[model samples]
Target: MVSVASPVRQSESRGSIEPILAVTAPDMKRVNDLILAMAGSNVALIPEIAEHLIASGGKRLRPMLTIASAIACGYTGEAHVKLAASVEFMHTATLLHDDVVDESDLRRGSKTARTIWGNQASVLVGDFLLGQAFKMMVEVGSLTALAILSSASAVIAEGEVWQLSAAKRMTTSEADYLAVIDAKTAALFAAAAEVGPVVAGSPEPVRAAMRDYGRSLGLAFQLVDDALDYGGSAADLGKNTGDDFREGKLTLPVILAYQAGNDEERAFWQGAMEGGRNDDAALLRATALMRRHGTLEATIERARHYGEKAREAAASLPRSPSREALLSVVDFCIDRVS
Candidate 1:
C-alpha cells in the first residue's frame, strides 16, 4: 500500500470545517452562480427537478476540485468555471440516480429528490443532467477531455452495477470493495482534477500528477464516508446513520470488521447481511461490536494514510495559492463529517 509521511494532524475538524470553508469562501458564490447557470437551460420540466436536487446544498466538492486543480496547474482560462460546473452536474446526476437505486430518503438532512419529486422524475432528470454534461464537454471541444470523462463515466457505471450484483455475496473481499470504490467514487474525482490541466493544455507529467492526487484524495474521502456510517452522528454527517448497513451494502469498514471479528461479531454480521433484514437494534449492536474490535479506527487510519498520500502526490507541484488549496483539500477530505 502506498504511504506518506506520518499523517498530519487533521487540519479541518469533522462536522465543522471552518478552515475549508475559509478556503472555499472566495469561490463559493461564483461557483454557485455558475452551477445555477448550467442548470437553467434544461427543458422546463427537467430544470425543475434539477433545481430541486441542486438546491439541496452539497459541499460542491467536485467542482472545487476542478477549479483548484486548474489553478494549481497554472491555468488562467475562464473555461474552468464551465468545466467545473459540468463536473458538478455529472456528480449531481449520479446522486439523483443513486438515491433511486438505494431507495434513500434523506440526504444532507433533507428529503431526497426521489423522495420529494418521485423516482421517475429523479431518474429522468438525472439523465437530462448527464446529457447536459456531455453537451458542455463538446462545447469545450477537447478530444482528450471527452475521453477522460467518458472513461470515468463508464467506470462509475460499472462500479454501480458491480455493487448491485455483489450485494450480500459472501465472496466479497477487500479487493472487491476497493475495486468498487475506485470505479464508483475515485473515477470521477480523478477526472475532475485531471480535466483541469487538460483544459489548460498542461504538460503530460503535470496532468498525470493531478490525476494521481485526486485519485488518492477520492479514495480517502470515500473511506471516511463509509466509516462514518457506523461512527458518525446523523445530525452532523447530514444523512441517516448506518444507512449502508441497513441497505446490506458492504463497505471497507464492514469488510475489515468481518475479517478481524470474533465468532459472536461475525455471527452478528452474518445475521445482518442475511436477506437484508437490518433491524435498528441489530445495526446498533453491530456498531458496538465494530467499536470493540477497533475496526472503525483501523478504517480511519487507512483513510488518513491515503489523505497523506494525496498531499505527497501534490508536493512536487510549484507552490502557489492553488497548491495550498489542494493541500488544504486533502486535509479537508479526511476531516469532513459527510
Candidate 2:
C-alpha cells in the first residue's frame, strides 16, 4: 500500500456521505444526464424499466468512488465522467438481475421492475444496460479500465449463479460467504475505484490503493446490510426487513450464529434455513437466536473492522480533496450500523 502523511478522523461525516457528494456533485449530474440519454431505446420497455430502477434513490456510491478516485489521483479530464456512468450502469444492471433472481417485491422503497414488469422484461432490460455499459467503456478508450469493469461484470454474474446453489445450504462456511460477496459486491467497487487512477495515468501503487479502499468499503457496506436484515428497518434497507432470513439466505450472521451454536441451536438453524421453517415465527426465532449468540453484534463488529481497513486504504492515497471524501465515505458506511 502507498503511504500517506496523516490519518483523517473517521467521525468527520457524522453518519453522512456529504463529503463524497460535495466532491462529485457536478460530475454526478453529468453522469445522471448521460444515464438518461443512454437509457433511451426505441424498444420502449427497455428504457421504461431501466429508468424505473435508475431513478430510485440510491446514493450512486460506486460511480462516485470512480469519480473521486480519479480526481484524487490528479486526473483533470472528462473521461472519468463516462467511466463513472459506466460503473453505475453495471451496478444498476446487477440490482435488476438480483431482484429477478430473488423474486423480490421491493427495491429502494419501490416495487421492483420484475414485480411491476415481470421477470422476462427485467432480465432483458438488465442485458440492455450491460450492453450500454460496455458502449460507455468502449467510448472511454482505455482497455485497462474496460477490462476491469468487464471482468467485474462477469464475476458478479458468476457470484449470482453460485449463490443460487449455496443459498440455504447448511454447509456454506464463512469463507464461502466471503467469496460470494467479494465477487458479487466488491469486484465492481474495486474496478470502479481502480479505473479512476488508471484513467489518470497514476502510478500502479496509487491505482492499487484505490482498489483496496473500494474493496474494503464494499465489504463493510454489505456486512452492515446483512446485519440490518435482522436488526434494521425497511426504510433504511429499502426492502422488507428479514428479507434475507425469509429467502433462506445464509448470510454472515446466520453462518456465525450457526457455527458458534451448540447442538440444539444448530438444529434450530438447520430447520429454519434449510428445512423451510422460514415463516414469520421462524424469523422471530432466528432473530432471537442470533441475538442470543451475539452474532448480530459480532457481524457489526466485522463491518467495523473492514471499515477501518477501508480507511487505512484511503489513507494510503496521496493527500487530496478526493481522498478525504473517500475517507468520509468509509465513515458513512460503517456508521449505518451505529
Model 2 residue runs over 4 Å out of place are 1-13
Q: How much RMSD separates candidate 2 from the native structure?
A: 5.2
lDDT of 1 by residue, 281-316 (tens): 878777776666666777778888888888887887
Q: Which of the numbered candidates is closest to the native, going by highest lDDT?
A: 2
The lDDT values for all models are: 0.79, 0.86
Backbone clash count, each prediction separately:
0, 0
* TM-scores vs. true structure, each candidate: 0.90, 0.95
Residue range 1-338, candidate 2, lDDT tens digits: 10110121234446568888999999999999999999999998998998899888988999999999989988889999999999999999899889988889989789999989999999889889999999999999999999899999999989888888898898898989988998889889889999999999998888888889888888888888888888777776789888898888889989999998889989989998898788988888887887777787777777888888888988998788888999988877777655
